[model samples]
Target: MTVVIETRDLGKTYRETVALADVTLSLEKDTIYGLLGRNGAGKSTLMSIITAQNFASTGEVRVFGEDPYENAAVLGRMCFVRESQKYPDDFKPGQAFAAARMFFPNWDQDLADDLVKAFLLPMNRRIKKLSRGQLSAVGVIIGLAARAEITFFDEPYLGLDAVARQIFYDRLLEDYAEHPRTIVLSSHLIDEVANLLEHVIVLDQGRVLIDASADDLRGRAVTVVGDASAVSGFTSGREVLHTESLGRVTSATVLGTIDAAERDRLTAAGLDIAPVSLQQLVVRLTQKEEVR
Candidate 1:
């Protein structure tokens, strides 16, 4: 796999606040990455630094194996759709599309037009006058239509309803299948975008917490449910993420995979096993006092 973007011990600070700390990771080409984290987890900070919109306080960032800051060749191959992307007061959705078409070498006007129609965006309305959902649509359209070699979508679904968000996801997958590129999606709605991620990079407290393939991360944890005593006995010596008890019944979520033999043992002990979803695992892992 080709590493399109690489960062080494990246650190960012503003006075006393540290936005990112000693973060290092690689983004492979043609893969969809889910940048999952809480509101202040440094997801946007990391993307901003990589895109050269913001500078790192310490460490290095390389795009296409070269510094991205002020590098037109590298910057031109990337697109950043920010949650609060700014636009000219007088510019309309159509004008924004036109501007993007000229700036991105791989811009697809047909796709942009289709997306405009799909989202029911008003072409001639001033951007400042558009609804929040409409504003989000404009960003989503440009990001997908640009088809940049590396695209960063930092919470691009803001203000979008469930149906509209689904539309964005569906169209993204369809276009991606035809024109493959690196996509980094930063979102608090982890489960909604979980299926679209080939790889997952989770940040917490301005540091890298988990970096792994989505498939591998999926099997990294499991939930066991049954009688409180049985579940507690089985979870002994394991890393338990969370546990809840209702009377004599208990459900315990724990880290680590269960082999066939373990499964049989759990069944024999009258315990029920359940698969943990990506969102559940992330929530548990990032919680301050959950792991035990």
Candidate 2:
């Protein structure tokens, strides 16, 4: 239950636009966290600030119980891998891995070499000449091999094919099991990594919309479908997230757990209750908070 990263009233702004606002979050140690949000929802900005690659306009952040800015002692234990990670124009995958091996204290050369082969990276070719997927592969290889205590990957699977994406997921899980660490993965491919996440933090329009464990989020919302009258009656006085109606049929999504008594009542009302998918819940939660 030790906290690895924590922020208080964190805010980041650019001229007239605010990228992050009054964000307070606590990330526990040795757990996989999914930092999910739509594009422009401040996921990357938050990651950059936490990694000390960018400065926050206001508020404070602590990594490993100390300030991270220019603190090599703390920064050395963290790695931030993103699609925008640039290498010298002439540097190749092999060169990048060699450099990472020197920077990260826990770098695993064997893992790096195996990943290079699995990714089929052209070690001889310049990084600038690689395709998008190839470039993404380079980032993934470095991320896994770095073995930092805290690693943040911001959409590092940009152009990977389904097969390559699966490989990344497989390797990440395999490695994490053997050497547990705090990992924050920010990706738009929600359903793909939904099961991999132990906890999820969702941002919407510069605000933290949802932060909860995967298990708790699973039952945080439920959808019921049936006759319009029955569905309406069942969801009344409850926190309805989303609702749709077609003729006399209606389906409504409500936020809150339905315990035994509520479940029995719903069953008696002839309403069929279905569990909500994580993707569906996030889509509803960050979807402008539609009025039912």
lDDT per residue as tens, model 1, 199-232: 9999998999999999999899999999999998
lDDT of 2 by residue, 34-138 (tens): 999898999999999999999999999999999999999999999999978899998988889889999999999999889888888888999999999999999
Tally clashes: model 1: 0
Per-prediction TM-score? 0.98, 0.96
Residue 165 displacement (Å), model 1: 0.8
Cα error, residue 145 of model 1, in Å, equals 0.4
Name the TM-score of candidate 2.
Answer: 0.96
Candidate closest to the true structure, highest lDDT: 1
lDDT value, residue 132 of candidate 1: 96
**Listing every candidate in turn, what is its Cα RMSD in Å to the true structure after a full C-alpha superposition?**
1.2, 1.6
List the lowest-lDDT window of 10 residues for candidate 1.
283-292
